[model samples]
Target: MNAFIYFPVYLVLKSEEEYAVYYLPTDFQSPELFVPRKPLSDQAKRAGWQGFLYDLSKVPQGAFIRIV
Candidate 1:
């Protein structure tokens, strides 16, 4: 059997009406960057100091919302 572990990505607010996506790979020092190629959800607007999880492959509907 094959085992798999899924990690979390984040939708962080950079500034007003602006945002950036960060992929926090396990044990990695610096987070990988992913461009927000599409329109974001309302959740993104609410992303404060504690950014929300934007897990992609793990979400049943291919993610709760699109950020990239």
Candidate 2:
């Protein structure tokens, strides 16, 4: 079976800190990223960036022995 999904990316940053991170996609087929914090929050906004296409096929398949 083949499955695909859109993975939203976010720009997390503080006053002087910044880095790219992965966010979750909304159920409506569109992702909504919200940043709520201190002064940094003001600058934190949707980067309007596109998510990369992740291919699960590249991952090695293994037996699931544990689930928690």
Choose the strongest candidate by TM-score. Answer: 1
Question: lDDT of all predictions, in order shown?
Answer: 0.41, 0.33
lDDT of 1 by residue, 1-68 (tens): 01324355455648787776644444332222222334455578644333333334443433334455
Q: Evaluate model 2: give its lDDT.
A: 0.33
* Clash list (residue pairs), candidate 1: none
What is the C-alpha lDDT profile of model 2 across 1-68, one tens digit per residue? 01435433332434555444433233323212222233433444754433344332432343112221
| Worst-scoring 10-residue span by lDDT in model 2 | 28-37
Clashes of each: 0, 0
